[model samples]
Target: MAIIKCPECNHEISDKAPVCPCCGAPIADHVVTCPECGKVYFSNQTECPQCHHLTGKEVAAQADVHTKPTNVHKNNRIIIMVVVAVALVVCGICYAFYHNAQSDKEQIAYEAAMASQDADVLQNYLAMYPNAPEEHVDSIQSHLEMLKAIDRDWTNAMVSGSKSAIERYLAEHPNSPFKSTAQHMIDSIDWSVASAAGNVESLEAYIESHPDGDYVEEANDAIKNLNTTTVQPEDKLLVAGVFNSFFQSLNARDEEALTSTTSPLMTKFLGKSNATRSDVVTFMHKIYKNGVSTMKWQPMDDYKISKKDIGSQKIEYTVVFSAKQTVTHDDGSTEDLQYRVNAKVSPEGLISEFNMVKILE
Candidate 1:
């Protein structure tokens, strides 16, 4: 190895030497050097060993001594860079993942901004990255088209008396992300349109189709304002059957059966003034004991559902009942009975109310 000049002094020193040994200078330190005494000293020393001269170079040189470790680190970094490059070649597939991850982040931001009605922000993002992924370009175009269409539809629905324009747009863009919003707008408009036209059939159909729609209550309110209407003939059958059974039971003196046929409220009302089960038993017992068992019951004709009213697809049917009954007592005494009955029927064929009157004959 070639000899190195001592940094502490201007003395030639052997490279492997620990010190100069001539002036007791630390030659291997390569740091502080005496300017006048031609002596070397350790880098931390503040004076020349031979001449006792103060020197600041020792401190500066000590501060710089750590730089040699950095050169080794630099060389190590070169080796690491080479390894990384080789790894990239061995796993080329990782690059695609990196690209897709970055693209997804951009797409998420663009979609979020668009949803928040920030069209300018979205446009700026698109302008900055005009050449986005091919797969995302078509989606972005479709979203932009939907936004424009929705704005136009809102304006048309506001100006026009109908929401048909909005409905048409939604039908055309059924696959669009704004389809649900378009549907909501159309449903809102349907209520006003149906009400203006007094189209009960259409209103009922719409309510049936969209049970949980926002317009359901409003459409029903409109239906309730319409004049009362007649119920169907088939529904009248159930009303007549139930009333006839009740009338027959009353005439036959079957108090238990009659009570069973009447509603709970009607039963409670009748109990205050009418015969109980014991009274019916005593009457039957007396008739059997006397052997005067002539009892006749006849149902009246021309019974029908009348006084109808309709509201929000519900129908109310008012029915009339007339009947006659004759009973002979044990001593051949006879009694003739005549009845007039009125019953109210609900939309679902359940009886709501009934009143009976004894007609004098």
Candidate 2:
């Protein structure tokens, strides 16, 4: 029998043996050298087990073919490889052209939508193509330019008091992209319309109704500047001081102090009926025992003095009050509170109409 060697360990074995007895490597097979590591192994393996390098039967086949004559089998394999490579290159080019064509179609649609000045069409295009390309920028710029013109026309209509056109336009196109801008334009018209109409009552009422509206602050400022009734600075300060004194008197629960400052109208307004000095003192004692500590008052910028009526025999102005108070309980815990007070003063420097507004906790 012919002796064979194991590829893994070079152990010798009989040619008919299935495995080498020394290293347990299979021996009953044809083996080849691994090109990367020069290690001999079974020809069917694609990688060398020792070096882990890729090797294939193709390399061995090509080597065999080179050793033989160039013939029909060799020519056929070469033609087949060339045909497959060309087909792959053509497929790549076709895919690129198809993608480019689709992109061009979308870009043209975006431009056409903008040029038509139809907001619906533009929004639809944007929805369909959220990732717009660089080419869409020019169309967007043109749309912005058209919107600027519309804004100019809207502003002029408001200034010239011909707001009907803009109003009708806004009503007709409520869902227009410029709806927020149109609302601002309409408010500007409201300011001019309210002022030019010369209805002070309506103006004040409108301002009061729309406290946080866009026109509220501007309307208030206009009212302050356009006020025809003027009060002496000294009298304005005195009335404000008197109201403060009255609040302090009430806060301290000092009946004598409150009675001295209050007039007959104020007494009635405070819901007191025919009470003299002694009775007031007794009532104040009871109130002081039951009531919590009176909170202090601080002034705020929104607090102001305005005449209730213009140029009447009865001079009148409003005295607005705002204050932040810290109330302490007997248990030594304290809480902060804020108050807003509005007082309408008569010619006699008395608070005729006193209204307490919201409290903030």
Model 1: per-residue Cα lDDT over 1-361, one tens digit each: 4465665455777856865555444445445556887665555556766898876664657746745644564677688889999999867868887888878888886667556444456566677667877655666666666667766766665466456766666666565555677677777676666666776687787788678888898878766544345334556576777666655665576777655554443212222333344443444445333554666656586577664546565767777768677777777888888878666665655445655678975
Clashing pairs in 1: 8-32, 8-33
In model 1, the worst 10-residue window by lDDT is: 265-274
Candidate 1 to truth, TM = 0.37
Find the candidate with the highest TM-score and give its number: 1
Provide the overall lDDT of each model, using Cα atoms, as 2-decimal numbers. Answer: 0.63, 0.63
Candidate 1: misplaced stretches above 4 Å? 1-118, 125-150, 175-178, 189-208, 211-239, 246-275, 278-320, 324-338, 342-355, 358-361
> Tens digit of lDDT per residue, candidate 2, span 56-111?
56755644544333244356657878999999999999999998988898878876
RMSD to native, candidate 2: 26.4
- Per-residue error (Å), model 1, residue 358: 4.2
